[model samples]
Target: MNLTPESKVLIQGFCEFISGTHVAQMQAYGTNLVAGVNPGCGGQELHGLPVFDLVEEVIEQFGVIDTTIICVDPYDVLDAALEAIASHISQIIIITAGVPPLDMVQLLRKAEACETLVIGPNSPGIIVPGKILLGTQPSEFYTPGVVGIVSRSSTLTYEVAYELTKAGLGQSISVSIGSDAIVGSSFLQWLQILDEDETTEAIVLVGQPGGGSEEAAARYIAEAIDKPVIAYIAGRQAPPGKSWRQTGTLATVIGRDPNFGTAQSKLAALKEAEVPVAERPSQIPELLRKEIKIN
Candidate 1:
């Protein structure tokens, strides 16, 4: 999406004036935060923005909102997003964690039907370094540059960004699609965006061992992406053949069906795709330098 510093934003829950709340950080970063939505807090002010009872009310006051940051509780996340979708909000960033996968599945369906981009149900959200803060990505680790970063884990995303920053490599955009087993978006989606992004000269893909997203991304990069890609798959030390069943019991599998969802498989796929794979976060910038000329 064409999200910019000038994008009008709304919050689905109260932007409390306290630590750990994204309001102060986003506002301080110069985000165009318009208003908020909190039922029963209508006509009241929080974090210097008018609080309304509904998404439509916020829109009525602020006109068309380009994006919304859903800060409601986990259980209320689906309803909050649906309200935003019903109000025709084009993009949503969900900050709440522990949302049931079924709820996310429901949200994804409606989001797809409405053609809305949902960032996360348990995400740190998206950040364009010096431009705008759409979610809770620690802005201190980011700087405006040519490398675009996409990852499933928030903390790892931060650590990798910090490494890039220390190596004198900065990010054009950093996206944490969420660490949940089922997230709103995928690696390919953001990879496509970064591939088309004029500002992104290279991409750093931070993935973990869980699902098939990393392998899928490797295939896409091999086929579609023109920009140089550097990959780092976490959990290489994680035990293999241990799959978490719905009953919470781990079963030892035999062969690598579905690529075993292992880091080795992801690393191998990326290598087969000719994408440079970093054994650790510190190696990322070096690998990137080898792939693309960067100052």
Candidate 2:
């Protein structure tokens, strides 16, 4: 779970207000802002960071970028993603803004062909505590520790990490894999990394009502992982035909066989498989304490 320092991150859509805020937040977290791309804001300064009109110009000046954070509108997301893949400047690319699923499907196809690790077209980005902060989350809420957290909801990820810190349990890694249906990566992918991380003693998975991803992970945990897992599946009893906050939740509800009963059934599957499922958010800390002996 150690985050090695890399050269710089090339950020997309520097002209937006939220993008500017995200840059400042990352700077506070100690990440060097190397370059930015905005088609209209070329040659201007954004919060003291140089802005370029295009990705090519930014890459030409900055050399290789370790990461790229996309903060543009959904309409522009696919083009930005293609540019990121073509540039080959970063090992990781994070898309913080929400994009259409149809666009994401095309983006994912390109990403797989390019072999690039894309995180979120609708996410909070990844935080490798004490090393780099590449998303919209507050830096003060994170610390370097031995627990790895992976969640679908950005807000819930923040709350879970906050609670862990309050209980004196810091985190080694915290990832919000976005709430979008066709977004990059999955809970299992992050869980694989955490399972092998020597610094991680336990895992905290925050899932919402939707998808069998949690159930799949629970089966993995039951068979493969030895470390304790503490889970909280949100919106279990959410009424049918209503969408929850997470986009993935809504998609899972809409596209499944029974059409909308997947969430509660997924929770039941996890519990049946012996995964410690918290019925409520408040029960998470206490359950985790008992399972991991963190007291």
Best-performing candidate as measured by lDDT: 1
Task: Evaluate model 2: give its lDDT.
Answer: 0.76
Clashing pairs in 2: 179-248
- The candidate maximizing TM-score is 1
For candidate 1, what is the lDDT?
Answer: 0.84
Off by over 4 Å in 1: 14-21, 242-259
For all predicted structures, in order, the TM-scores are 0.92, 0.89
Question: For residues 1-295, what per-residue lDDT tens digits would candidate 1 score against the true structure?
Answer: 8578899998887432123456788888988999888898898888788889989988887888999988887788899999999999999988777777888899999999999998876677889988899877788888889999998888899999999999999899999887664678788999999999999999999988767788999999999999999999887887876532311122335664845577888888988998888889999999999989888
Tens digit per residue, CA lDDT, model 2, 238-265: 7865666556543433355674335777
